[model samples]
Target: MPEVELLLRSRRVVTPEGVRAASVAVAGGRIAALLPHSAQAPPGAAVADFGDDALLPGLVDTHVHVNDPGRTEWEGFHTATRAAAAGGVTTLVDMPLNSLPPTTTVPNLHVKQAVAGPKAHVDVGFWGGALPTNRADLRPLHEAGVFGFKAFLSPSGVEEFPPLGPRELEAAAREIAGFGGLLIVHAEDPGRLDAAPAAEGPRYAGFLASRPRTAENEAIDALIALARRLEVRIHILHLSSADALPAIAAAKADGVPVTAETCPHFLTLTAEEVPDGATEFKCCPPIREAANQDALWAGLAAGTVDCVVSDHSPCTTDLKVPDFGRAWGGISSLQLGLPVLWTEARRRGHTLHDVARWTATAPAALASLGCKGAIAPGRDADFAVLAPDETFTVDAAALHHRNPVTAYAGRTLHGVVRSSWLRGRKIADRGTPLAGPVGRLLERA
Candidate 1:
């Protein structure tokens, strides 16, 4: 018998290597130890044994778009973070756009913190925005503790956060490099975008044609070149076009500091399958054809793609219109990222280890959160007990996000998240949050 604060035992515990029967000991909100199932709990220790369910590390989503402060009606820290907790995500990094004052300056970062400090149900970190006008503010924002800076090479959906041009990209990269900060880019060339046919109507094909793979490839090519020349770290966000994989791979092979993250929408949904007039499936750098989707999975399996995150960018129902061309582009999947990814991954013969690495580990690494993603000593004891084979139909209205609009509505997804624990306490039960918000605002050092 060993003394510990709490013991969570499961027949299938997801470890770094793979799943096995283990008992995890928690003390002072950190995992104090991991022992075999035969290990006995101390006399005063409390233990919860999950018979057939799996004990998994709480997911760390690094690409969520919690449009708070100015756009709280769209999504806010309170609602979004609660949804994350219900979904088994104990940590998430919010994107810097869609809010009134995008987090391009230190003051803007402060504003975000003020809004989120008490509202977050799971630990929330922030990514700052990089616009041409804010080039001078990048260093201070980085020093102020943003995980990284997000820049758009093409027009950001919201006008407040304008995209960075080639010159601006160079300037921003230089500034970020000086401070040793990371820059995550929404890679789509405006030149190619201007050349593509004008988008209008309900045709999914027309929409897909307007944002082709060429745009992604062209933008990545330029960013990779610039990153190499400047010796700066660049991350490509929400990679939907598989045509850019070889270049990304070659860049990594050539020692360029570049990484890419693809979203659950791009991996699971495709343009060909989307019904006409369904704007819920709409997202920027729109989901491509089946072949492209397959290539993206290959990129993930081959290690060309660094990770998978839920770019859980959501808006009001009115914003995601019945007209595909008029709808705001984003997917509301904060609460379904794990299930969606698990359903798809298992279908492809991949293990839960892959899911843990992609959703939990890599995202934490991107945020520079050293103790949040894994189930090991010194790491935070945030975890989930999952019924991997259980199925549930998605009910958008039942979702905890402010807006009930979602692309995954009505879909029968595998892998039910039975309960989510944040720092050794259960925070989720059937989509309702049970805690009084134990989450903190994480500022990257």
Candidate 2:
């Protein structure tokens, strides 16, 4: 009766019918109606039309590394969520490690929520840590609203969160399975990495050689076998080895409860293109050759890769210096995943709808976020209005993240987010958060 609140019309609106001109009605922070361009609006409703821009469901990036609490100097909720808003991401799930106390216990999860309460500008959820010692705390953290649990098969690059051995991994998986929780893993085999040559010097090849495809494939094979025997849901994180794609496909075909994801760096940049000593391009399970990149994209096209979320792990500038052997192995692209993906995806003949599926819908499904991720009745009014054809050069200093260190620093990218709305309210462009914390700690159903 109150004029239905607002109407946002766009030339390209991603919907069940595909991208087309449509006017969406919003009321009480949810989509009230989706109508044709010429349809009448509810009386007195305010309207804003994006002439040539596309209106997409705000991206749900489930793999951001907002190292807050103890490591807020690296990244925090305030800066990370502001970056998310500008990047067209409306919802993000924070990784458990890097933060002090990590999100292993129920008390630690509360510490994270309390720290993030007044700072976040976009909707945020969390993942729990799966340290060997924390498996006993899994059910309690899951019950307390953590989306799922994260573990590593190799060293986690941090002293606080160590990797689990095969037996420890199975034990943790069993605990998670007993609670009906999911286990997301950083699947690089320690044994294979140990067998490989040590990475040294400035050459990217040396670094790439240290973490080979066999490391990923071998670790994945173990995970697949464990998932089948343990009856647990397992997701491989930041998959870079294309050789493992067939194994993943076969496991899925055989009904193993396993899924995998790849980051933007893997899909956009290849080992051939990376210059020696460019530590910014360095990441674990290092970016492989162009042929491998093509295979990773093929995996996405064939639906073997479930999602394309930015594993936006960032650190200080000093940590990402020119020395490849000593620098941190992560990329900071939380605010640029859309444009980076769009630039490469279009050249490869993929659509924005595919981008939406990879960046928004699929990630939400993986995290079990029911109200976020899509444009539909009863869903949160989270949306991104983009000038899909606009191009912009990257300037790391202009970004909202705490550290101005990013791999996309000089590259040009397509797709610009003109505006973003969260639960019927515009943020970043205008207005402060309505009241208290808008993000609710999410849980999987």
lDDT of each: 0.90, 0.87
Model 1 misplaced regions, further than 4 Å: 1-3
Number of the top candidate by TM-score? 1
Error of 1 at 15 (Å): 1.1
Error of 1 at 94 (Å): 0.8
Report the CA-based lDDT of candidate 1 relative to the real structure: 0.90
lDDT of 1 by residue, 1-445 (tens): 2348799999998888788999999887889999998789876789999987988899999998898899999999989989999899999999999886788888888988998898889998999989989888888888889999999988887889988888988999999999889999999999999999877788888888899889999999999998899999999999999999999999999999999999999999988899988889989889999898999999999989988999998898888766777889888999999999999899999988888889898888878899888888888999977899999999999999999888899999999998899888888876788868889888895
